[model samples]
Target: MSDSIFSIPIIAGTFLLAGVVKGVIGLGLPTVAMGLLGLVMPPVQAAALLLVPSLVTNLWQLLAGPRFGALLRRLRGMMLGIALGTVAGSGLIAGPATGAATTALGLALAAYAVVGLFGPALRVPPRAEPWAGPVLGAVTGVVTGATGVFVIPAVPYLAALGLARDDLVQALGLSFTVSTLALAAGLFWHDALPLQAAGASLLALVPALAGMALGGWLRARVRPGTFRLCFFLGLLALGGELAWRGLG
Candidate 1:
């Protein structure tokens, strides 16, 4: 890891911004964090710093929801697929192909941003979820392993499941939580998660929590739709630059 790129102020600030995004939108912590941090560090190192804050915050969201048990039973197969897919790509972090990982991360973010900006409010019939859930989860897990970003199809798929607003938020939390844990296991498997990175991630939690609180407060004052649009545009630009740099 580059000493300059992996500094305290940078990590703290990146996570703070990510938390704000997640707090306002109910998702985007990993996506935003990876997009920003990926500019300065390798994907695997960025992922190492991502684990703690992402896990803790999303875990709270998971347990705070109203329909925890029911959602679990409903989404079990998807969870299994996430774990399996993550295992399949575990060695990615331990490798030296920084360009490959950066390109993957950039493409994922750009695609996700495009979807958020223009994707329809799709609805998945109840009958389709049994199979659709696992397939999407596997794909999300593969993306997570490759880039440390967890949203891709998971968010859209969950939105399509016809969940109410609260359920959607909770489901995002649940899926992100599962993704975080699975990624952590993969990193640990390849010794990518060292003590220093763990400490930095933990240190970042304070700013993340504070930013979440700020975002929650802002939700009432600012127009959410506008904020969301700007956020997506920012991601699209950032992702494009990253991809261009990596490709070059």
Candidate 2:
């Protein structure tokens, strides 16, 4: 990675864009940052940059809600799955092979976009929660470890659980927070995240927070569905490009 890409302007701009998406939709920061930064740096670096902002933002979101304990208990299966799966696959991502990590990230992004755009609505019955949660969590964990993206089946699965709007948002925050921590641990275990990268990630949080403030302001003025459409469309293009680079 070029040292120039870590310049304040570039890093702030990248995180600002990511933060806005996250503020507006309550997700997408990591996705946007990974896609854009990957153009200049390795996937591991991109993922490393995402750590602090993702953790801080999601923690705030999680604490704002009233159902933390309940949600934690309820999602225990999925949570455990995510932890184990992430541990299992994190090495693949933080490993020396940038090509493999990039390919995986690209595929994960594309898969997420396709599912967001065209996948069927998922519905899990109350009786099925026990088995379904862990399975989805495990998949999301592996994806997070391998690609540094942790939405996929996890978000959709949470949505399918039939929670109210506020609860769902809180739940998403909890999930992201946990996922970020797991990824951090995984990277550390592999010695992929050095002190400098961690420092950069922490510094990047400022712009991300700023962007989120702006996004929050826009949330009421702009239509979420419309912004979501634009977001996914952007992801589609970015993902395609990354996939091509990885494949090449």
Candidate 3:
């Protein structure tokens, strides 16, 4: 979408809010930002606008800590899944299949939010199989590339792996960074990435970075259960809105 007078403030406010949430939670910038932006911009444009900021923030997250090598080794399979799924999803976005994918994304996000809120109590048996990470990562990659939804399928797998909270957050951040860059490239190849979209995405980096910082700080002080509750609720609301828009 072009930067019209009406869209400027909307874009700024969306990023600001998205930044704050990401700053507190270590993720959700794209989910929250794209959700809001979808109200004002086309779904594809909203997803595109989040590309630059998401890429930058994820790069920082991936590189920010000690034990990077160990973490990478542990999550390597998932990363591979992310790569495969991202390519598949991005290819789908180029055809007439986008609408069905978008609608499914909206519903998936909604289901994720609901399950995240209530299903943690019902733990699935943890799998020791090597294929788990790849499966989860691939699913996350597809959802992310197609609709900017990153938390589904992957979050449960991450949790199941018993990763330290910090590790989980960092891994997710890195995964998103890689997947978003790939998706953006795919969009560009398909002539979907315009200069205006790139500019807006770059501008959004400011708030996204700020929010990531804030979220990292907050993660320590907040109760994990409470934070999850609130975050999932936010997701639910966003997902519901998306579904409504799609159906309408």
Top-scoring candidate (lDDT) = 2
lDDT at residue 209 of model 2 (Cα atoms): 98
RMSD of each: 1.2, 1.2, 2.6
Residue pairs in candidate 3 whose N, alpha carbon or C atoms collide under 3 angstroms: 19-211, 23-211, 23-214, 23-215, 24-215
Tell me how far candidate 3 lies from the true structure as C-alpha RMSD in angstroms: 2.6
lDDT digits (tens) for residues 1-248 of candidate 3: 86488887788778877777777767777777867776666667887888888888778877886667887887888888887787677755544554555565577678788877776643334465367778878888888667766677776666666667788777777677777877787677767778888988898787777766666777789886788788889778878877776776
* lDDT of model number 3: 0.74
Residues 91-112 of candidate 2 have per-residue lDDT tens digits of: 9888888887888788878887
Candidate 3 runs further than 4 Å off: 94-102, 121-129, 213-227
For candidate 2, the TM-score is 0.97
**What shift in Å separates residue 240 of candidate 2 from its native position after superposition?**
0.8
Listed in order, each prediction's TM-score against the native is 0.97, 0.97, 0.87
TM-score of candidate 3 versus the correct structure, residues matched by position: 0.87
Model 2: how far residue 126 lies from native, Å = 1.0
Instruction: Please report, as a residue range, the 10-residue window in candidate 1 with the lowest summed lDDT.
Output: 86-95
How far does residue 224 in candidate 2 sit from its true spot (Å)?
0.9
User: C-alpha displacement of 118 in model 2, angstroms?
Assistant: 1.8
* lDDT sort, best first: 2, 1, 3
Candidates 1 and 3 compared by lDDT, better number: 1
